[model samples]
Target chain A: MIDESRRVSMDIHYEISQHYFKEATYLQNWKLREWLSEMVDEEILYWMPIEENRLVKDRRPEPTPDDAAVYNDRYKHLKQRVEQIYTGQVWVEDPRSKIRYYVSNIEAFHTDVENEFAIRCNVLVLRHRRDTQIYQHSFLKEDLLRKTKAGFKVVRRKLTIDARSVQDKNLFFFM
Target chain B: MSDKDVAFISGAVRMYRERRGWYRSVCNVFMVGEKSRMEMRVMINVKELVDLENATQAKKIFWDQDIYDQEQERIFGRSWLFLTHDSLIPKNGDFVMSRMGEDKVIVSRQKDGSVEAFINSCSHRGNQVCHADSGNAKAFTCNYHGWVFGQNGDLVDVPLDTLCYHDNLKKAELGLRKVRVESYKGLIFGNMDPDAISLEEYLGDMCWFLDTILVGAGGGMELMGPPLRSVLDCNWKVPAENFVGDGYHVGWTHAAALQILGGPLAGLAGNRADMPYDDLGKQFTTRHGHGFGAINDAVTSIHPENEEYADFMAETRGVVAENLGTPREELYMSHWNCTIFPNCSFLYGTNTFKIWHPIGPGKIEVWTYTLVHKDLDIDVKRSIQRQAIRTFGTAGTLESDDGENMSTCTDSNRGFVTRKGRMNSTMGINREGRHPDFPGIVGASFIGETSYRGFYRFWAEIMDAPDWEAIKVQNDNWDEIWRGSEFWSDK
Candidate 1:
C-alpha cells in the first residue's frame, strides 16, 4: 500500500483522465470513426459482454475474452458499424438518441508490461430515446493504454456491465 | 360455469381479444376474479376473428391478454415447442434454461446423451429451482429452502424431511412437472400435452424443407450460443408472421442498411422500381403453420462482403446436391426467411436463428443464435457468427429496423376502436398450391403473404382444436382451405 514508486503521480493521472474525457466527447458527438482512429490501436480488442446471474458453484468472476458477448469486435467490423451509423439510414441511429457518458473515478496504475498502463474507470451512461424511459446504467471498464508517438492508444478494452439482463431497446453506441 | 362452459368462455375471451384490443387494463379488469362476467361481455364468434377464407385477421390478436392466455394453454400446451439444440448441452449434467410458451423449463443432457426437460419451478413453493441461464450441474438445489432435484428432475433430497413431516412426505410424487421431449436432427422440442402427436408428426412436410438448411454438407448445423437475449416491446406473432413470409418489408424497412452494405440484395434498396420482383424466389407452407420464403442465388446476400463464406458454399453445393437432391441443392444456394409454427425462425443465407419468447401480449424476449454448418472450418464458422450478429443479433442493424415496426404493430392496436379493423394477408393467396417437387403449398413469388395465410390458418386451427385428435381429423382437409387453382401444376 505504501509503494510510492508504483503509484502514478497526479500529473500522469490528469493526463490519463484528460485523454479519457476526449474519447468520451467523440462518442457523445457520434464521431466514433474519429475516436477510433485517434485513440484505438489497429489490433485492439474492444469487448462488452453480457452478464448472467448463475449459481455460486458455476460463478466465475471474469468470463474469458473469448466467451460470448454483446460486442466482441475488431477494427474492420467496428469501422463498418461507424460507417453505417453515419449513413443516416440505420433506423435505430438515424434519429440518434441523446447519450451522455460520465467517466470518472479514474485510477491509473503501472503494469509490468513495457510502456503500458491500466486505466480503470466507472462509466455512467445515460441514454434517452423516443418516448421511452431514460436508460441509465453504470459499468466498470478497464482499458490498457500504451504510450504511442501520438500520446496513447488503447490496446485492449474490456467492459463489464452491472445488469442481469439488458432491458433497453438498443445499444447503438459504444460504452 | 361447468368445465365445458369454462373452456368455451376462454375461447370467447380470445375471440373478443382478437376483435377488440384488450390491453393490460382490460386484462386487469377481468383478472380480478370477474372472468365469468367478462366472458359474457366477450362472447364473440371465433369465426369472425380469423376469417381464413378471406385471409383477414383481427388486430386484437397482437395485444390482447385473453388471446395470449388461450395461446399459452391451447397452442403452446399442445404444440412441440423448440427447447434447445443438442450442441448446446452436449455432456452429462449440462443444462440450458429455455421457455415453453411462458413457462420456464430446464433442458438437461443426461448421462446417456438423451435429453430431458422439466419446469424450472420448484414443486414445493413454485420458486425457480435453477436460476442460471446455463451451466453444468449435478443437481439443482433450490436457493430458497434447499430442495434439491437431480439432473433428470427427480427429487433427490429434502432437508428435515423425516423430522418435520414424520416421514409422510412423498418426494417421488413431488418432482418438478415433466414434459414430453423429442428430437429431430439434433433440435430438441418439448410439449406439455401427453396426448399430443410426436415431434416428427408435428413437423410433417416442413422437414423436407428444413433438411436443406439443417442438414448440409454431410454434417448438420449447430447453434452458437450463450444466445444474445434482449427484451423488446412487440407482439410475438408480429415477428413470427414476419419471419414466416414478410419479404415485402425487406426491400423497404431495411432499404437503407442494404444499400449501404451493398451486396447481392442491394438492388432491393429503396424498393427500386425496376428490381426483379417476379423472379426473386418462392414461398412455401405445410400442413403445420411452418412456412418460409426463399430467394434464389442470394444465400449470402447480407454478407456479400464476405468472400470466404461464399467460397465455402460454392465448394459444398455439389456435396449437398449429392446428399439431398437437386431440389435441395437449388434451395441451398438461396436466401430464406422461415418460421416453425409458433415462434422459432431462422434465415438460411443470413444464418441467424431466433426464438421470440413472449413475455406478455406486447412484449417478448428475443433469444438469438448463429447457425452454421458443423463441418465448416472454424474460421468460416466464426465469420458467419460475426455476420449473423451484425445483421440480426440483439442490436443488429436489420433487427433494429424491424423492432420499431413490430412494436408499433402491437402498441398502436391499444385503442379499442383500432382492434375492430382487419390486417390483410391476401397478397398472393390465389397464386399458391401444391408443388410436385416440394412438399408444401408453394407460392410463385417470395415477396408474397402466401405463408401468412398458412401461418394463421394453423394458428386458428390450434386455437380452436381441443387436442391432437381434433387436429388430426382435419389434417387430410388442411389444404382444402388454400383452394387456389394449382399454379405450379404445370411446372
Candidate 2:
C-alpha cells in the first residue's frame, strides 16, 4: 500500500533519527572527538544560547547567535573543546556529569541545498553530578543534516533551553 | 590612639554601662524595637571577626546568619551597586532588572538621557512589579492585582481607583521606592542610601586604573546582556574576595584549562616550578576596597583563538597609552582580576563582568556579562564577546572550574568545628606599599592577598562605624594600617 516516494522519504526520516541517537550515545559515552569526526560536517556550527524571560508586551525573538551564548562554536572551536575535555585536566569535568538526552518530536524538511534536510526535535536532558539533585533541562533543538555518502552528518545544531536562567551548576555535559 | 586602644576604651564603656544597669535602661529608651534588639545581640565584633594584625578571617563570617543580616543592612544597603550599563538601555523607556544585594531593582533609561532605578516591589502589596529581564516599556503592571507603574516607577494607574477607595487612597504616596542612581563612563550604579558618597568618590583611586580599560580604545566599555545568570551555592564574599585578588589560584586551579588551550597563561599551567613567580605580576588596592591584580602583558591572552580581537587590542594599546599615560599604557595590555568593593568583579582581560548578588549567607546568584569596547569595530566587539564567554561565561570552562570550590568553601563552614576556624590571607603581608606611579597600596606580585586584607579591612571599618560621619573620622588614618613597612619605595 506504500508508494516508493513516500517509503523512501519515511526511510530517510528514520535514518536521520537513528543518526541522532548514535550521536547522543557518543556524547553520553564521552566519545566527543569520535562523534565530531564521524558524525559532524567540516563546517559545523554548534550553538547553545542564553534564554531571557521577556514580557508579552515586549515580544521579541531569542537573541541572535552573534549575541552572548553558553556555547557558540565552529568546527575548529568544537574540536578544541573536545581536546580540552580529553586533557584529563578540566576540573569541571574531571569526573564528568552523567547525562542522558531524550530526543523526541522529530520533524524533517528538505532544504534548497543539495542532500540537506532541516530536522527539528524537542530534547529533555537529565544531568546528575557530584551528589547533587538531577538537573532537568528541556530544550528545543534544530539540526541541519546533510545526506553524505556515509549517511547523515550534522552541519549545524542550535539548542535553546526553556528556562530564562540555568539551574545546573555547570554545562559540562553536552545536550 | 592605637586601634587596640580605641577598642579597649569602647569595651570599657560597654562594661561600665553594663555594671551600672544603664545599658538595659538605654535599651528600654532607645532600642525598644525588635529589629534593633536583634541587631544589638548579633552585632559584628570587628576585632573578633577580622584580625587585620594576623590577616586571618573568622570562618563564622561566611556561615553566620546574623553577620549576613548585618552585612545586608550596613554594607549592601550603603554601597554603590552596579545596576546596568548605558548600552543595555540606550533608548528612552528601556529597562533592565538588576539586584542590589538581595533587593531586586528595575533600572530604566529616562527620556532625558539620565537613568533612574527603583525597587521592583509594588507599593500596595509586596509583589514583584517587573519580571522581565530587559525590555522597552511604557509601564509595568503588577500581575497579582493590576497596579500599574510608569517607566519612572511612579504609580500611574490603580485597578479600582474611584470605585473601590473613593479617592481615599493617596496614589501620590504609593509609588515604588526610588533608588539613588549615578553613572561613570556609561556604567550605571544604584544605591539605596541617599547619604552614600558619589560613585566617582566611592571608586576613588580605582578610577585611574579603570580608565585604562573602561576609557581605552577610542571610547569606553559596554556590557553585552541579557546576562548569563546562574546560582552558586557559596557565600557572596567568597567569590568577591576571590575576584578581588585570587591570582594565586589561577595558575593552580585553571592550570589544566590554560595548558590545553595554550594561551599566554598556559606557562603557569600545573604550577610549573620553573616559572618566575615574583616577576609574573603585581597587585593593588584602593582606599575604598576596590582592587586588582595585574599580570603584565596578558591582555587578550585568554583569546588565543581570536585573531581579530588580538589585532584590535594591539591597535588600541597605543591610543590607550596616549589617552591614559605610560603607567596605564603598561596596564592597558595587562590582565587584571578586580573587585569593586562589596560584590562587583570583572577580569579586565577576560572581560567577564560579574555581580555576585547574595541570596543569603550561604548562597549567591551570579550574573555575568561580556564587557566590550564601544568604539571597536562591530566584528571586533563580537569577537571579544565570544571569546570572553567561551572562557568565562555562565557555563564557561574557567567559571565551571571555580564553582565547585566556591560552593564547598561555604557549605563546609556549616560544621561547628569548621565555623570556629580561621582562614588565612597573609600572602605578601609586609611586602606591599604605595606605588610610585599608581595610587593605593601595591603588592610586589599578582599572586598575593594584599587586596584581600584591604577588602576585609574596609568591610570591618564600614560595619563597625555607626554612620558615614563616623567613618570619615578615620579617613586620614586608613593607610596607617599598612604603614609599618615601605616595601615599594624604590619602585
Candidate 3:
C-alpha cells in the first residue's frame, strides 16, 4: 500500500541504517582486529587543503607518511592501539570509561554506482570520565560517517569543540 | 648601639653570613624560619643572560624543573597571559574554561559587560565547579557537593547551608578566587598578581606588531571555536620559540607538504637554490620577545581559495595605514608566523591561532583556534574555519608533520648527558642589528634568528632576576644590547 516515493525512501533508509548499525556494533564490540585482517578494498582516500588554500593538483604528491620510520612507527602504534582496547588497557579507558556515541541525523546520497550509497550523519559523543564525578566533561565531537558493504565507517570526522581552548582531561575516546 | 640598630645589623650580617656559608646549621627552629625567608629571597635574575644566537640543539628551556617552577611563579603568575577572544563569550553568563600552566580557570562574561576569571576549583573543598568546556550558565554548581557559584564568581547559595554551618560560615570568604582580567582589542588576558605590569606595558613593542593584523583589517578578528586540542611530546618553549621567528624550518621540514600543495611556494620545496630569499619580507624581534617572520606579497597564498579574505585584507590596508601607519599596514599584507612569547602563537595569513599549554618538562597540550574577522559573512567564516582545520588541526597534514618532529625532538633530548650540552640558536649571527624605520631590532631576512635571540634573552632575564624588583631595573637597558647599523632607514 506504500507509494512509490515512500517505498523508495524507506528502502534507502533501511539500507543506510543497517550499514550504520553494523559498523557501530563492530566498533563497539572491538572488531577492529578482524576488520583489519579482512581482504576488502580498505583503501582510504583523505583529501585535505593545501598550503595554497586550494585543492591539490594532479602533480601534487599524495598524502603519505612523512618518513619510513614514521610509517612503521604509526603502523605499529595503530596495531598496539587496537590491541590495548581489546585488552581493556586501563590507561586508555580510564579517562573515557563511560561514553555513549550517538550517530543520528543520517542522510543518504547515491555515489557513482547505484548499489553503493554514500551515507552521512551527525554524531554526538558524551563521556563521563569517572563514576559520580562531574568536574571534567569531554568535549562534544562532530563527525562525518560513511557507509560501506562491510559496515558504517568514519570517512571524515571533524571534531568541533565549543571552547577556544579544550579543557578536557584527554582525547582518548573515538567520536 | 641602640637596641633596634643592633638587631637590624645583626639580622643583616646573619643573613649575609648564612648565604655565604657552605653548610648552615640545621636546627629545627632555625630551619623553619630560614626556609621561609629563603623561599622569599630566591630572586630570579631579570637580565644578564647568555647569548642564544647560536642555538643548534633544542634548548633546555623545556626540561628544567627549576625553570618550569620559576616560570609558573614569574611568567605565568605575574604576566597578563592570554585567555580567550572576546567573541567567544559575547553574551552575558557565557563562560569558557582555560588553563594557566596546570591550573584550570573559568572565564565568564558577567551581566555588567565585564569579563571575570576565577579558579575552576570549588571554594568549599576545591572540587572543580564547572565541567563543560563552554556554555551559557546563570550559576555553576559543583557536582561533588553542590556548592553553587554565580556567573560573577560570587558564592550565591549553598545546599542546606543554614542547616550545615548554622549561619556560621562566612559567605564572603568562600567566593571563588578571582584573577585580574583585561582585554586589548578583544583579546582577553588573565593575571594572578595584582602588582604585575599592565597588559600594555607587558606587550611593549609587540602592540605595534599586533596592530598590523588585529587593527589592520577593517574589522578585528574573532576566534572560531572550539579549538583542536592534541598532546605533543615536546617542551612548550620549542613551539613558542619556533613560531617566534623560525621561518627557516618551513622550506626544509615542510618541503614535502609544500610540494603536495603546489602553491607559489612549491618551488621553494627542498630549498631550491633558485628560490628568492632576500626578497622575502624582513624579520623582527621586539623588546618583549614578540616576533614574526613575514613573507612579502604572499599573504594570499595562505588562503588563496578564499578571495573574499584576500579582498578583505586588501581593502583594510589603507584604513590600517591611517590608524597605525605604513609599518603595520605593510605587515597586514604579509604572511606572518608569530608568537606572543611563552605560550600564544598564531598565523595571521593562515588564520590559525594556538596556545601551547605546558603539561610538564617534555609535554604540551596544543589548542588551536581558527581566527576570522568579526564582520565577515557566516559563509566566509565557515570557509576560513574549514581551511584552518585542513592545515592546523590535529589531523591536518601540516600539523601532523610538525607534531612528529616536535615529539622526536623532545624524546631525543632524553639522554641524560645529552641534555647538558647547550643548543645553538646563532642563525645570521652579527647580521641583525638596530634599524631606523622598524621599532624593534630588525634581522636582515625572515629566516634569521634575531627573534630567537630576543626570546632567550628575555627567558634568561626572567630565569635570573632575583625578584620582581630586579626585573624593573633592566627596563632601560633592553635596547642597549643592539649595536648594528640602521638598515631600515632607507625603507
Candidate 4:
C-alpha cells in the first residue's frame, strides 16, 4: 500500500510535469504571449544563436500597472503575427501554410534547489507548404521549471536547432 | 604628300573617333531608357545587364544568365572571394566546403600550417571529391573513381592507374587545380586568377575599415559556425547593396519587428520626425567599394534589454578607441549595415556575419555565421549565437522578411521586356562628395545611393576590362568621376 506522504510527492511531480508539458505545448502552438504572462518571471533571459562566439539575448518586457492593457497589447502583436498567415502580412508564412510538429522524448531532471526541475525534450517539426513536399526540421529545448504556489511555471528556456542551415521556407512556425 | 593632305587625314581620323564615341553613348542612353520602361511593364530582366555608364536608371541585376556567366568569370574568378575564417581551420588537415560563384571549392589547412583551396570536383570524372561539408583529413578520396588527393591538392594515388596505363600515365599532372589563397587577420580569401593583384592591395583602404571590427578593443573576432545556410530567390547584389549602405530599410521594412522588440530602434517604426534623422549617423563608401550605413549610439539595437551585452560593448569601447583611434572607435559603438564588395555582408555591432553566396543571377545561397569577440565569456558567446540565429538565421524574424523581398525583386525581372528597362538609384546623386575625415565620397545621409554608385562603378570596371593589365589604367582615375565637387566639405 502507498503511504500518504509518498502519494502526495507523486501527485506534486505529476502536477508539475503536466503543467510544464502544457506550457511547452503552448509555446510550440504559437501562444507565446499567453505562456509568457502565465509562467515566466519578471526577468527571463532568452538566449539565441549568433554565428561564432556571439549571442543575441532578449529579456521579457517589463509589465505595466495596467496588466490587462499590457497583456492585451502583447497578445495583439502576437495575434497580428499569427493573423499574418491569412493576410500576407508576413510573407514567409504565406506560401507555406502547413506545419506538423512532433513534441516528444521528454526528460525531467532535478535542479540544485528542491522543488525546481529542468526539462529537456526533442522536437521534430515537419513542414509542408502549397503541396505535399516534406521538409524535416528539428530542435532540442531545455526548460527550467519551478514549482510555484499555483503549481508550476517556466523560469527559463534554451533552444538549440540541429541543422546548421535553417532549411525551411521561412521561420513561420514557432519551434 | 602635301602638308594640307596630311592635316586633312588627321582631322578625318579624329572625326571618326568622335562619331564612334557619340554613337556608343547614344546606344547606352537608349538601352537605359528601355530598361526603365521594362521595370514598370513586366518582370525586370533578372540576368541581362547593360554597361553601368549606359544604365541611366537602376536596373535589376538578379536574373540574367549572360550577366551571371560574366560575373563568374569577371568578378568571382578575379576577385579575392572570402573562403572561411582561419578560426574554422586552426588545425592541420581541417577542411571546409565553400562556394565561388556556383562552383564548389574545398578550403583545407595543410600540414605545413598553410591553407590551400581547390575545386571540389574530381579531376578524372568531374565528380565531387569531398562529400562532407567539413572534416579533418590528411587526404580526400573520390567516391566515384577511387582517386586519392592530398590535403594540399596533390594527387597521391589512383586505384587503376598502374593497372590500366602500365606505369605510363603521369600522376603529377592529374592533381587538382589549386587556387591562390590568402588571409588578412583571420579572414581567408581565395582567387582563381594567377595574375590577380595581391589580396592586401586589392583590399586597399577597406583594410582600415575592417580593422575597426576585426582588431578593435585588443580583441580579435572569430566566426561561430557551422553556418546557417538558406536559399533566397533574389539577385545577390540586392542584399549586398542593401547591407552595404541601405539603412533606410531598417525603420521601414522591419517596422513590425522593431515595434514588437521595443528597444532603442523602436522609435523608428512610425517614422518619427523627432528621432534625430540628420544626426543619426553617416554612410561611407571605400575605394574598393566596401561600404556601411551606421546608426549612431545604437549598437545594441537588437538587444537593448540585455544589460550584460550593453556593459560588454561599453567596456570594450575604451580599448577600441585606444587601439583604432576615435573615428573607428565611434564606428565600434554604432550599429553598421555593411558589405564587402562582390558579396559579403554583416551587421558589425549586431554581430551577424553573412556571405550572399551567389548560385546564379536570381538565386543565392546565403551562409550566415555569428561574429563575436574571442575574449568574451563562454556563456556570453552562447547567448550571442542564440540571438543571432533568432534574428538572422534561416528562421530568423528579420531574415524571413528580407527573404521575401529579395525573392520578389529577383523574380519580377524575369520578363524579357522588363529586363531591358532601368530602375532608379539616383538618390543623392549630385549631393555626395569627399569629406576631410571620411575616406570615400560621403553621401548626405545613411539612406543614400552613393555606395550603390560606387559598387556599380567597380562592377563596370571588372566587366569591361579585358584583363588585369587593362584594369591597371583606371586605378588612378577612380576618384576622377567624383572630383570638382564640394557637397560634403561643410558637413
Docking class of 2: medium
DockQ for the candidates, in order: 0.51, 0.65, 0.06, 0.15
Q: C-alpha displacement of B180 in model 2, angstroms?
A: 0.5
Question: Candidate 3 at residue B361, lDDT?
Answer: 79
Candidate 4 fnat reads 0.22
- The TM-scores, chain A only, for the candidates as listed are 0.90, 0.88, 0.53, 0.58
Compared with the true structure, what per-residue lDDT tens digits does model 2 show for residues B348-377? 878899999999998888899988778778
Which portions of model 3 miss their true places by more than 4 Å? Answer: A1-175, B1-59, B484-491
What are the runs in model 2 whose C-alpha is more than 4 Å off? A1-9, A59-61, B1-37
Arrange candidates, best TM-score first. Answer: 2, 1, 4, 3
Model 1 CA deviation exceeding 4 Å by range: A1-7, A59-65, A112-115, A147-151, B1-44
lDDT of 3 by residue, B1-491 (tens): 68697667657655654563423333332554556543533432222125543444344555766566777777777767779999888989888889988879999999999999999999888999976767778888899878889998889888888997898889888899999998888899998988777788888888877777676655777887666666666888888988888888887676655655556766666778877787787788876678888888777675656888778777777888898777777777788888887799988777889999888877888878888778778877777776666556654535645765676567666678876566777876666677766677888888788788887777776655545545554676676667545455554
Candidate 2 collision pairs: none
Please give, for residues A1-175, the per-residue lDDT of candidate 4 as tens digits.
Answer: 1122322345555765577567657765656567656776544443323222121221323222111110111233334444433333454555545656676766666656777777777878776654454577777766666777765665555566666555554654543
TM-scores for all predictions = 0.90, 0.92, 0.73, 0.76
Model 4 chain B weakest 10-residue run by lDDT = B38-47
Chain B TM, cand. 4? 0.88
**What is candidate 1's lDDT per residue for B46-76, written digit by digit as tens?**
5677888899999999988878877877888
Better candidate by TM-score, 1 or 4 = 1
TM-score for predicted model 4 compared with the true structure: 0.76
Please provide, for model 2 over A61-132, each residue's C-alpha lDDT reduced to its tens digit, 9 standing for 90 to 100. Answer: 757888889888888877777787877777766576788989998878777676888888899988887776
